[model samples]
Target: MSKKIYSVICGTGKYIPTNIISNEVFLNNHFTDNSGKTFSQSNIEIIEKFEQITTINQRRFADDNLTTSDLGWLAAEDALNSSGIERESLDYIIFAQNFGELRHGNTGVDILPSLAARVKKKLNIVNPNTVAYDLLFGCPGWLQAMIQADYYIKSGEAHNVLVIGADILSRISDPHDRDSMIYADGAGATLLTSQTSNTPTGILTHKTRSDTLEYSEMLFMGDSYLPENGTKKGIYLKMHGRKLYQYALKHVPGAIQDCLNKSGVLLSDIKKVLIHQANGKMDDAILNRLYKLEGDLSVPFDVMPMTISWLGNSSVATIPTLLDLILKNELDGHKIKKGDKIIFASVGAGMNINAMIYQV
Candidate 1:
């Protein structure tokens, strides 16, 4: 009988920019409303409320000279170097991103040369047969890419694949908007290779869903009035936080449960859940709900590893970066061992929600 093929994670890497912006920085800058009036005490309170809700203290911003692909290349290089696989042997490159490249301080997304293709070139891979492409699946893009790569390995269509998630959301944020505090920049990558084994040890089961028909406009980027110049049209990332939060609360738990059920893994078997670093309070609530579903009210304090306190929300890069940090022993008190079960989940634009089960 043919050996059972599994796509296993061999290496992981991440790149966080040097430029840091703290909450105090926003407090120092005067913000005004669209009606040409400065925010009053009520508006000031919103900033404090954001701090309570998101638990984001600070985030990094790419230097003016750096592009989205630049961040991605740095991460990809680290992943490739650690994988011990020759660059020429890579069978595919799957790049997941929301904003391609931020220009004019996040007002535009540059897509002329695809970010994936650029990273492939920057890596100096000489093989023309290695396929490279981009995936736009909101914040869950990286996990989705992994799902795709998992299939390729299982089907014997490829031996190795690189999955990357990176974004410079700080460029496209409206500084005057409170939501600006929630966006940041970074990139993360992982290398998955096929291995013949008697038992499955990689991605066990996964599920992804979209509700764009009803919630398409919940989280998005489009033309909005720049507070600096009321008449000029500028693009910025916008979201109805409450609606998005509600949607996540309602759907994410079901997705995770469905994934667990499909994989035939019990809730007690999961060691950690690496969810997208979107909002701290909301994430905790999602975990609480998931635990309740298992008929347990007690939630482990360390089950979910978080980087949003410093990383903010880098869209697709959040999960991979957090995973890399934990795997490298950079995150305190979190460790993975063989036979450990983990769950990955995220919700983002396109009103997309997804989750996956993996064994380490």
Candidate 2:
């Protein structure tokens, strides 16, 4: 029997931040359209409708003194502490992020050294062979990094990989943009070690798709909705919410289904789904549509676990954070056991969609 090497998650950690910003925080925000025209609806009306759609009631924000790199470093530290793996043994440190390091009130982002490098420095790892780098694949960045790490482990190029997803979306979010309420700050990290076995375990198969022809601008950076804000103004994270929502519902399901097929796994065997928490309703629709494609198979009551309501959409952080919580038994009524089949899927800024079928 031939043995195959797979990347198994040896440790998981998350940083959810201490500052809680509730929906009420936006009550005084003067949300405006791209053209700078204020919405006719009252802030209360807007917030209620936003909550109803995104199901985000509150979210965490990093302390003013912390930057994106700090979040990644903290989560990486936690993962390393839990794994009991010597820091010098790591072969790679991949930091999945988009916004880089934007201070609380600063419009500029600091990414010259790379967040991974910063985290490596923070951990005091001196191995130049570790190869620290950053990946900016939007919200799917973390999962994509995991896929890349899997490749490294399978190719025997790496024995241990540290994948960290961190972002302070609150810093890049335009206060005047209604979508700002959906963004948050958080980080999550995982340590993957190579395991050779006859049985297929850990990451089995994955799929990715990019629809950039027309969907390229679903999520982008643009000037704040407010024409005049007292804070230093520059491009902030913006999205065509309606278009992104529609695109996700249409493509995410098929991408996941394709991944399932690639693994030759039955949809019925998928015990849990840890998907990007971009939006609560959109995720619900994606799950429903996915099952319908498989002959209206009923979704198990706890098939999907979500933390969007409290965590908001922290870009690359969302999926990994959900994963850490589940693995640590921090999420109620959700747990992944050995031999469990799970799906990790994400759709984000590249108009990109990806999914992977994994076993534990």
Candidate 3:
């Protein structure tokens, strides 16, 4: 048997902001319909219902002084330091984010310099060949970047890569929209390096699905719900919450199954399902449906680790952040040992859904 080169996660790190925003922050938001019509329910009632649905009490927000690139740099530095690999040896730096860097109080594209480029500059890598680029696949961006890194390794185009998932939804969310409560700011990163081994380890098999024709606008930017909040020209992250939820329920589980089938890995062998923390109720339903498909009604308590309850949904950052936490033993009762098979899956803005199975 010949050895094959695979992309293995060599290091992991994350940056969770110190500023905590709680549900109370939205208690006085005066949320309204798309036409600026005020809600009939009181803020208290709305928050209660939100908590019941999303199980999110609070989330982090980068300090007003920080930018999305700053968060990415922090996470990248942590991952780089942990890997103990020379910075000049990195072949690529992939920064996964959606709305560029729209800092607090300044709602601008700020995309002149890609976040990856900015992060690379911050890292001060003198190597001109360490190609830096940004990706915009919405919440699944980070996972997608990892998949790309795997390709680079398997194809022998690259050896070491820095994949960073960082986003600051706080700056892009419409303050008048209740959905804003589900958005958060955080960054997480992983270092993937090429390795040759006879055993099936690291990244094994992966699958991705995109349903844009019908669900293209399921999650997109639009004018604020409350017209009085700002100029009509200003836009923010908006979503057809119900439609998106339905789409995830209909497709995400199947996508997971596709990756499982591709890898020939049984559901019983996967010790962890590090799924995107979009919404608590939605995640619960997705996992339940997935387990049910395996003829098992009970989902093992540790099978799916989550951070949405306190971290909210930081778009691309969710999965990597959750993985970093568990691997570092920061998420209580969750730990992955050598040879543990885990699955990473996500569904987000592109109406994109993906799943990957990895052995650690």
Candidate 4:
């Protein structure tokens, strides 16, 4: 029998815009409420409360000249350069994002010329056979794309694939809404290549599930009316924070446990848990519960590295960017060594939750 094929992450890259929006800036600006009236003292109090809840001090936003595809392209280029892989040799490109390109001051997304296709053109790759497509699995999108690429490599259908997760959520956010502080813009990319290996490597196992029937409405983006504006339509993201927090607390731990069991990896062997940078508090709670499932009441503080305080929640871009930072030794107290086991988990829109086991 031929040697077993496995997919291995060859390189990683990330792109964060230069524009910074701090909490102080939000405080200085006047914002209109849903009723078209300026926010009162009580509404202004929400900013401080938001900082306490999310621990997000600031976030990056793309420049007016850039689009979501542009961010993804810059990240993809860096990933390719790090991997030393020829662009023409890539067999596939899987790009993930919830909102496509957004016009300044516009809440609608541009759907034509898919982001994946745009990245392909930006890279100037001449291979017509290289397949490219966009994935929409919410925040778990990048991990989902990596899982799909693993199958393609294992099936001998592809040698290498580039996976990207990017979003310009600021473009779609309502500046008047306090929740907009949690959304940012950024992109991350990873290159996975197939290789023959006798021992297990790369993605060992994964689990993805969605609770659309019960929790889909818990978080969404849709039209919101401004009182005096007379039926204005803006697709702004909305979330029932408390309900979603409860949902995550109930389900995320179980999902991590299932992934570990499926991969035959012990909790003690995992060097790090790269979770989605959604809410710092929620993420800590989930990790606390997850460690408890392993029969340990004491939680390892450094086992998970967080970027939400600086990067905010860029949806799908969270995990890959965190991974890139850790891999490059940019994140303090977090580093991955060869043969170390890592677990990735995320929860986001679609009420979707997923976990994956990977070996470095």
- What is the overall TM-score of model 4 with all chains considered together? 0.94
Separate clash counts for every candidate: 2, 1, 1, 0
Alpha-carbon runs more than 4 Å astray in model 4: 29-44, 224-232
Give the per-residue lDDT digits (tens) of candidate 4, residues 175-217: 6666678898899999999989888888889998999989999
Candidate 1, 1-360: lDDT as tens digits: 556988899999999999988787787655555444566656457668778989998899888888889999999999998889888999999999987766544445587578889999999999997899999999999999999999999999999999999998887776666767899999999999998888878888999999988899998765443355453464678888889999999999999999999999998888999999999999999999999998875887789999898889999999999989988899987898889999999999999999999999
TM-score of model 3 vs. true structure: 0.98
Model 3 lDDT on a 0 to 1 scale: 0.91
* TM-score of each predicted structure versus truth: 0.95, 0.98, 0.98, 0.94
lDDT of 4 at 76: 96
CA lDDT, every model vs. true structure = 0.87, 0.91, 0.91, 0.87
lDDT of 3 by residue, 1-360 (tens): 689998999999899999988898888788887778888999999999999989998999999999999999999998988889889999999999998986878877788789999999999999999999999998999999999999999999899999999999998888888878999999999999999998888999999988989999999888887665356455688999999999999999999998999999999899999999989999999999999998775788879888998999999999989998988889977999998999999999888999999999
lDDT of 2 by residue, 270-296 (tens): 999999998999999999999999999
Ten-residue stretch with the least lDDT total in model 2:
226-235
